[model samples]
Target: MAKINWKPGNMLYPLPAVLVSCGNNKDNYNIITIAWTGTICTNPPMTYISVRPNRYSYNIIKETKEFVINLTCENLVKAVDYCGVKSGKDINKFSEMNLTIEKATKIDAPLIAESPVNIECIVKDIVKLGSHDMFIAEVVAVNADDQYIDKNNKFHLDKSNPICYSHGTYFSLGKKLGTFGYSVAKKPKKKYRKK
Candidate 1:
């Protein structure tokens, strides 16, 4: 395979597309779709979402210091795309996108009730990095919808039909979130690579 260096840019493929809801109250509540987000630490449950300084929700999150990361699925893809492009200042995202806001258990920010899982975060620090400022937050609470509680989905959490973004397009990874030891389990006697 021949590989050529194009340009210095964000070449990381397949990132979780999340709807981050922010604001202190119902009047100021807003949602912004973000792909530049993920878990950074495990001990205290930390995560970060990078947002453009000019975004509508940027100041809301900055002042409130709280937000909810709503994991997106196939059904929410249209809304995700719309939310990312449309400014919350011009329109009510929750009403326009038809998303219900639920009160977070441990945080002041409201969560998307339709989402499979909502991670409530409290902003620990803010690092201004070029065009986007990274909101480094600590996960205070996580709410998983009761619909996901099933013995049948013990191994695969694919029922939600999760969606991810690569470059400019959103893609769905079908089934099997992880199956690490499948090969080893099948051929135990064969010596394999570094574990």
Candidate 2:
């Protein structure tokens, strides 16, 4: 095998492209598309989202200490891209993107109704990293589109065609290969046919 050396950088790609909505009031509500976010803990249901201090929504989130992470899908690619590039300080992102603002149950931040899933989060801590500040939050509530929920209550997230960010490009999630523990599961046994 051959390898090439490279400088230290953020090489982690294929991250969830989520629209983080923030603000305490309707006048200041805004959305900022973020790829730098993920679950930090499972038991406590914690997550984190990194944002640049210069971003318009950054201050809103910091001051309010609350936000909603709206999972993006193929249908929201255009709006996601626009929210990422445009400044909320100059314009209302929800209105500009023509996205519906659904009321969050646990938080004041509005959820993107078009999104398949909306995770309501309350900031627990703030870590100032270089370039971006990380907001570590506890998941207060989650809202999934009823259409994607099965009768068994299992969420078909993949069916929503979730989108991700890689480097500077966006991509849709591919086909599922296997479920967790598939490698170690016991195989089915066959019985001999009766003569």
Candidate 3:
């Protein structure tokens, strides 16, 4: 196959579409849909979300220095898109979207009750990039819906049918290819039975 060179740009697609909740009080509570977010560290549990400086929730999160990243699923696609387009400054997103606000344990920001997982974070640093500012935060707490948890304590995140953003459109995750490290994993040997 022949290859063609293209201009340098953010080609990374299929990113998690999350609803980031911010504000310290009920009046200021707001939600901003974000696709530019991901886990940065595991040892201390860190994550980052990038938002334009002009975004309504940008200053809310900056001032409070905390936010909750609510994982989006198929059921939340409409609300996610609505929150992304509408400015929180002009309207109350939670009420308009018909989403419930569950108080977070370790942070002032409220969690989206409809989300399967809510990750509470406290801003550690702010990196000002060109178009957007990146908020680097430490994960203070994580709340998972009890319904998604099995008796074995395993979280069925896939069952939630999480959605992702690719290029300029949204898509649902496809079928499971395999579990981690399945290629090099050892296979059980065949046992001989008594003849």
TM-score for candidate 2, residues paired by index = 0.97
32-67 per-residue lDDT for model 3 (tens digits) = 999999999998999999999999999999999999
In candidate 2, where is summed lDDT lowest over 10 consecutive residues? 88-97
Q: Model-by-model lDDT, in order?
A: 0.91, 0.95, 0.96
What are the C-alpha RMSDs, in order, of all predicted structures? 5.2, 0.9, 0.9
lDDT of 2 by residue, 59-169 (tens): 999999999999999999999999999998899888888999899999999999999999999999999998999999999999999999899988899999999999899
> How does model 1 score by TM-score?
0.90
Q: What TM-score would each prediction reach against the true structure?
A: 0.90, 0.97, 0.97
Which parts of model 3 are misplaced by more than 4 Å? Answer: none
Error of 1 at 83 (Å): 0.5
Comparison by lDDT, 1 against 2, better one: 2
Candidate 1: regions farther than 4 A off: 152-156, 183-195
Error of 3 at 195 (Å): 2.4
